[model samples]
Target: MRSYLIIGMCVIFLIQYFLKLQWLEYTVVTLSLLAFLGSTLKADKFPRWLGIIMMTAGLLIEWNKDTGIEGISEGIFLILPLLSLITLSPLLSIPLRLGGYFNSISVLLRNLLLHPKKLYAGISGTLFLLTPILNLGSVRIINEFLEELKLPSALSAKGYIVGFATAVMWSPYFASVSLVLLYLNIPYKDYIIYGIGFSLLSLVIGNVLFAIWEKRHPLTKEAGVKVPLEKQHQKQLVKLVFFVILLIGSCLVIEHITNWSMIVIVCLVSIIIPLIFGIVSKRWYELIPRLVDFRDRTVSMLNNEIMLFMSAGMLAFAMKGTAAANGVSDFLTTLAHQSVLLFAIAVMVIVLCITYIGIHQIAAVGALAMQLNAVELGISNISLALLLLLTWSISTALSPFSGLNLMVSRIAGVSGVQTGLRYNGLHLFIIAVIGIGVISVIG
Candidate 1:
C-alpha cells in the first residue's frame, strides 16, 4: 500500500509539471504531508525532526499571511520532482556497482595509494570525477574501500567532504546547482562557465591545505612508495572514463538541442543511459531484483533532505507574501544601493550564520532569494549562484547537523560536532574569506 501510494504521488507530480495548476499542486502537496505521516504509522519509519520542523514552520509562516495551507502545499509540490529524482538515484547506482567498473577503479586507486597526501588527492580526485554520475552514492564506495585499506579516517573524511562540496558547486546534476538555477533563472551554460574556474580553485585549495595538515600525521613520509598499475586496471579505468564522458556528453547534447533545464535533462538522461546499457549488456534481468530491493530500502534515505527543502521552499513563499518580507526587500534594495560588494558580503554572512544554527542553507537562500532576486545589485546572476553554491558547500562541511556531516561522522566514528564541525572550521574560514573576496571583485 505504501509503495502504491508513493507511485501515485509521483505520477501526480509528473502531471503537475505540465499542468502547472495551483489547485493540483496544493492537492498533491497535501497528500505528500499525509503520506509522510502515514509512512511513519504504517511502516514504522518516522520522519526526521528536521522535516517536521520544516513542514511546521512553513505552515506557521504561511498562516501569518493567510495562505499557509496552499502556499506550503505548493512548495512541497515544487520539490517533489527533485525528491523523486534523488530517491530514484539507485537505479543508476545499482548498475554501476554490478558492472564492477566504479569499484574496480576505486580498488585500483586504493592499491596504488602511497601516503596521506596521495590518498587525499586520489580520493578527492576520484570523487570529483565520479560525483557527477554517482551523486551521494559514491560516498559508500569510497568509504568501503578506505576501510578495507585501513586508511586514515580523518584524511578520507576531509578529502571526501571537500571533494563532494567542490563537485556540487559546478555539477549540472547536483541539487545545489539545480535549486540555484531554478531560483536565479540563469542559463545553465553561464553557470558552468563561471563556476569551472572557482570550483577547480576550491578543490585545489582544499586538497593542498589537507596535504599541509597531513605533515603532522605519521604517514606523510610514505607518500613516495612505488606502486604499479596493471594493464587490466588501466583498461578498466579508461573504459569508465569513456562511459562517464558518454553520459555527460549525451546530457549536454540533449540539453542544448531541447533547451531543457540541466536538472530535467539529468533526470531523464541518468535513467535512459543506464537502462539502455543494462538491457544491451544483458544485465537487466539479473539486476532487477537487486535494484528493486535497493529502491525499497534506500528511497527512505531521502526523507530528511526532501522534507527540509520542501518546507524551506514553503517558508520562502510564505515570507514572500508577508509585509515583513516586503520590508526586507526594501532594506536589501537599500543595501544594493550602498554597494554591490556589501550586498554580496551580507548574503554570505546571512547564509553562513543561518546554516551554523542548523538551518539548511536552502532555507536561507529561499528566504532571501525573493528580496535579493528583485534587486539590481550590479552582481551577475552567475556570481550570486556561485556564491550560494560555495556557501552551501562550506556550511555543510562545518555544520554538525548537516546531513553529510552527520553521515561522515558516523562513518568516521567521531562526534559530528567535534570532528565534522570543529575539524573543518579552519578550512571553512579560509574558504569564507577567499570566497567573499572573490565575490566582491566579481559581483
Candidate 2:
C-alpha cells in the first residue's frame, strides 16, 4: 500500500512534466506525505527521529508566520522533483540484474584483479565507472563479489566505497549533483566542465592513498580466484560498458534536444533504455516479472529515504526567509568578502561537521545552500556547484551516517564510524588541501 502511494506520486510527477497542472503537483505532494506517514514506523531510528524533528520545526515556523496549510504544502512540494528522481532512477539496474550479466562481469573482475594494489584499483575503478548508473546498487554488487575474494577488510571497504564517492562528485544521476544543480539553476554541461576534472583528480588521489596504505598492511598472497577469464565473461564485460555509455549518452543527447533538467532526463532514460535493451536482446519475456519484483522490493527498501527527504523538503521550505537564514547569509557574505579561500574552506568544514554527527548530507546541503548567495560569495554559480559537489563527495565518504557508508559497513563487516574515520580520515586531509586548491583556482 505504501509502495503504491510512492509509485503513484512518481507517476503523477512524470505527468506534470508534460501537462503542467497544479492539481497534479498537489496530488504528488499529498501522496508523498501519506507515504512518509506510512513509512515512519519502519524507517531507521535516526531518520525517523530526525524527520519528526524537522517536520515539527517546519510546521511550527509556518504556524508562527501564519502561512496557513496551503503555504506549508507549497514548501513540501518545492523539492518533489528531486524525490521523484531518487525514487525512479534505481529501476535502471533491474534489466541488467535479470539478464545475469552481473555474474559474468563479476567472474571477469575476480580473475583479472589478483594483486592487492591492482585489486584496489580495479574495485574502486569499476565502481567509479558504474556507480553513476547503479547508485548504491554498485556498492552491493562489488561488495558481494569481494566476500568471496579474501582481501583485508580495509582494502575491500575503502576501495569500492571511495570509488562510489568519486562518482557522486560529478554524475548527473546522483541525488547530490542533481540537488545542487536544481538549487543553483545551472546547466548540467556548465557544471560538468569543471566537475569531471575534479572527479578524475579525486579518483587519482584515492588510488594514491591506497598505494600508501598498501605499504603498511601488505597482502602476501594474491587475492581473488585465479581461474581463466572466459570469453563469454569478457563479452559480458564489454556489453556492460556499452550499456553505460548508451544510457548516459542518450541522456545527454535528449537533454540537449529537449532542454529538460538532468534529473528528469535520467529518470526517463533509466526506464526507456532498459525496455529497449530487453527487446533488442530478446529478453522481453523477463521484463514483466523483474519489474514487478523491483517495484515491490525497492520501495520498502527506500522507506527511510522517502521519509527523510520528504521531511527535508518541509524544513527547506520553513528555513527560507527566516531570520536564521538571513543571519547565515550575512555572515557568509562577510566571510567571502574577507577571504574567498576561507569561505571555501568554511563551506567544506561546515558540511563535514554536520554530516559527521549523523545528519544526512541532503539535509545539511539543502539547509546550508539556502543560506548562501553566489554573487555575495564572489563565486560563479558553476564554481559554487563544484564546491558543493566536492563537499558532498568528501562528507558522504567520511560521514558514518551517510547512506553510502552505512551500506558499506553492512557489506564489509566494518563499523560505519571505522569505515569513515579509520579508513578515509587521512584521505580526507589530502582531499581537503587539494579541494581547496581546485576551488581557489576555479572560484
Off by over 4 Å in 1: 19-27, 39-47, 68-70, 220-228
What TM-score does each of the candidates earn? 0.89, 0.95
Best by lDDT: 2
Candidate No. with top TM-score: 2
lDDT of 2 at 385: 79
Q: What's the true lDDT of residue 290 in model 1?
A: 70
Candidate 1's TM-score: 0.89
lDDT tens digits, residues 152-264, model 1?
A: 56775687787777767777767777777777877676667666677778778878788777776655334433446668767877887787777667766876788876666
For all candidates in order, the CA lDDT equals 0.69, 0.79
lDDT of 2: 0.79
Off by over 4 Å in 2: 222-225
Clash statistics: count for each candidate: 0, 0
